[model samples]
Target: MTYMVLLAASFGYVFLKAWQQRNVAFDHVWWVLPTSYAMAVVEVIVVTKIVMTGGNWLAVFVLGTGGGFGALTAMWFHKTFLTRRE
Candidate 1:
């Protein structure tokens, strides 16, 4: 369950941050920092809870793996959706 949350938070964090960067690059008014901060807070709190509760470090590893996938997916999405055609 916590792993699921971690996965989701990581995915959302990367997706939103990447989306924001795409928008910003185009001179859009969308601000990504506040929402990205919220996502970071979620990650921090979840990790803290896991550590404080003595949860398995394996789960943390899984979370990190999820985050890596999330970042990759976000990059792929940006390249796919934000690109313009001639």
Candidate 2:
């Protein structure tokens, strides 16, 4: 359960942060503000949970793996679904 939550939190944290950055770069204030707010909230939760519970090597590995996939998926998701191309 802990590992699963950590995985999800890490994935969400990275995705929102990356999405926020993309929104900013594209000059989309509407997207930027909300993503920023969400990212901050998630960041707080992820850090607090990890700090309070502590993790073994396996948990740490899961966190890293989730983050890696999150970043890759974020870029693809924003470009493929969010961006408007003409």
Candidate 3:
């Protein structure tokens, strides 16, 4: 499925970035943004698919929004706190 491919790509990106930037302590965190955003998009797509298949739309919306926000918050924290400290 498209989701699987996207997930794999994100993983690959993370892996390559980590490998290439192994000397930098905060480099992994920077590379995480792409994976995190891809995951959020995947969550939205999955939720939409479930809703279209007769699942609860409200639940889907709630979960998708929460996941997206959570990922963004995590990225923000990593940038603001973790990266800044190093």
What TM-score would every model get versus the actual structure?
A: 0.57, 0.86, 0.36
Flag clash pairs in model 1.
none
lDDT by residue (2-24, candidate 1, tens digit) is 66776676666666666667757
1-86 in candidate 3: lDDT tens per residue?
43444344334334333333441555665555565666566556655555454655554454445445544555555566555452
Cα lDDT of all candidates, in order? 0.66, 0.83, 0.49
lDDT of 1: 0.66
Task: Point out where model 1 deviates above 4 Å.
Answer: 31-56
lDDT of 2 by residue, 5-55 (tens): 788888999888788888888877888777888889888878876875676
lDDT assessment of candidate 2 = 0.83
Model 1: lDDT of residue 82: 64
Give the range of the ten consecutive residues with the poorest summed lDDT in model 3: 14-23
Model 2 Cα shift for residue 46 (angstroms): 0.8
Candidate 1 residue-pair clash tally: 0
- Evaluate residue 51 in candidate 3 and report its C-alpha lDDT on the 0 to 100 scale: 49
TM-score, model 3 to reference: 0.36
Task: Give the 10-residue window scoring lowest on summed lDDT in candidate 2.
Answer: 48-57
User: Which candidate achieves the best TM-score against the true structure?
Assistant: 2
